[model samples]
Target: MIFEGYHPLDKTMFQVMDEEGNIIKPEYMPDISKEQMMEMYQLMIQTREADLKALMYQRQGRMLTYAPNIGQEAAQVGSAFPLKKEDWMVPAFRELGAWLTRGAKLEMIYLYWYGNEFGSYMPEDLKILPVSVPIASHLNHAAGIAWASKLQGKDEVTITYFGDGATSQGDFHEAMNWAGVYQVPVVFLCQNNQFAISVPRGIQTSSETIAQKALAYGMPGILVDGNDIFAMYAAVKEAFDRARRGEGPTLIEAFTYRIGAHTTSDDPKRYRSDEEVEKWKKKDPIDRMKKYLMSQGILTEEENEKIIEKAGKIAEEAFKYVEASGDTVLEDIFKYHYKEMTPQLTEQLAEYKAYLMERGEA
Candidate 1:
């Protein structure tokens, strides 16, 4: 197995390809079909286009604060590729590529960031949790889901995504501990994007590698090149297999970098130098994947340009659709929180509507 050779304590990432798209470890290259490879690349492109569009919308005061997943697409998309429709995905706020790969609608993503609660609603078939803004809190939710699935004798695995900073939280430890103890079929994916807002990974924890933390909880762990799609795919595919085999949780620390600000409200330049940014740009996940595809004759330069342009159009169309869906009904504000609106909420909704009617704005 792939995990047998790569230990977390090695301090070296398990990689199949280099930054220049050369397959250095051809043995570890995944068995993905060309069609799926192209789909992953397209998803990455769509993710970036959507992120850039969101940034523009936020700047123009048209959208609410959004977390961009520019540089971390490979980590998100590759890890999510192994998930079955019956499987569960619990996410932190910055996994746009993962959501897209796992069949989340682009318009839903846009609407969520547009401050609509309806955006959080996934189709019944897609077992995904809502976008959690709290750091590490959702780890517990993911663990609990896996625990329940196991208890009910269902063959389901749950995958949860969070940043490197989340490892410091008690929830992370608790979830990891519980999963390990119960041998729940869950994967803890830590997109170690080098920084947690202004704090760098070095200062976030004293451990040599985030993946190694899995050992403390009695699970297998491995570090993978987060920017290398093949590496990420191989690692997660194996992790899912182990989970399906009832071997319990595995921690995968995808060593990546966040190219944009932590969110629309923050500035990355304030804490990081342009030189460092440029250095990471050379390791762009989408670029490397495109190069690999081109080498395999699955894509050409001309076709890639067209694909990128089309992805932008898709993002634009999705956002336009979200906007065209019109504003939220004011009653939905007080109506959605409970199975039945309580008497107090009923009274407040009436009072609020009456006030709005008196002001001629209802």
Candidate 2:
């Protein structure tokens, strides 16, 4: 007999830590060691530094366009920590913290922003997919990969990242349907960072909470305080555990905000007011995490300085490495496609080489 208890559809937001970094639900906290907490803090610091450096690179015309992940560090880093090495991460473009936590090198990410295709080429052992720029396109791909893992009887789960805006895409629903029917091992992380390039979350959907939509797809959905790392980590770990137990998929709506412009080209002030930005800024993920660490005596002021310094050094080294590598060969792009080059590609390559040679630029 099913008891009609409290439904999560009642818009209950799960939060472990408050904006002031106080633990509000100690009983609900995950079993994260002090070492794990320190690591999470470091990842958040590194992410913020990387974002700032990328912005500078863009301003100086040293890099291509970038999508900043300034305020959502806790949401990305916390959720990424629980995955085993064999687990797959099919990521959207704005997942710098998550990628870094999953062992991706800063140099590779920098190369990606410099328009180097080699940047997105992750090592085979990492099990992370290349950044998907088209919104929600990889939704079904994550399901397909997880489904294959299930068929093979491998104990692996696939976790994918997307924005709240992606819920509008038909691919999202299709992926949900597949996961629901097959009971595949996959976790859907929707970072609801307020705006999807100027469109507010309220305008994105009529549902009171994005998590509630999971009911229609026959899955469990949890709305988490994205700025609270503790809550974020706990929710994601539980979801993955459920999937590994053959309980099917989960949808996590991380309630956070994007502190910066959507991309380098965007001007957020054109739509949202400065006051709203200031409000979210006060709840900055990194700051809250720092407060929690300090309160627990796990992080000292000296140690905090070192973490920030190390992160800055890493970003600096990445920028230097990418700049020193020089531009990729214009013709090299044609090589990775096919061993036996197509007739049209061969013709184009030959034409381009001839043109370059004529101009003494080959």
- What C-alpha root-mean-square deviation, in Å, does candidate 1 show against the real structure? 1.2
Please give, for residues 230-344, the per-residue lDDT of candidate 1 as tens digits.
Answer: 9999999999999989999999999999999999899888899999999999999999988888887999999999998999999999999988983677888898788899999
For model 1, state the Cα shift of residue 297 in Å. Answer: 1.6
| lDDT of candidate model 1 versus the reference | 0.93
Best by lDDT: 1
Candidate 2 to truth, TM: 0.96
TM-score of 1: 0.97
Clashing pairs in 2: none
Clashes counted in candidate 1 amount to 0
Candidate 2 residue-wise lDDT, 1-362, digit = tens: 00012144867788889999899988777898999899999999999999999999999999999999999999999999999999999999999999999999999999988988788889999999998999999999999999999999999999999999999999999999999999999999999998999999989999999888888888888888999999889888988999999989998899999999999999999989999999999999988988989999999999999999999999999999999994787866876467778999989999999998999988
Q: Please list the C-alpha lDDT of all candidates, in the order they appear.
A: 0.93, 0.91
**Model 1 lDDT, residue 130, Cα:** 92
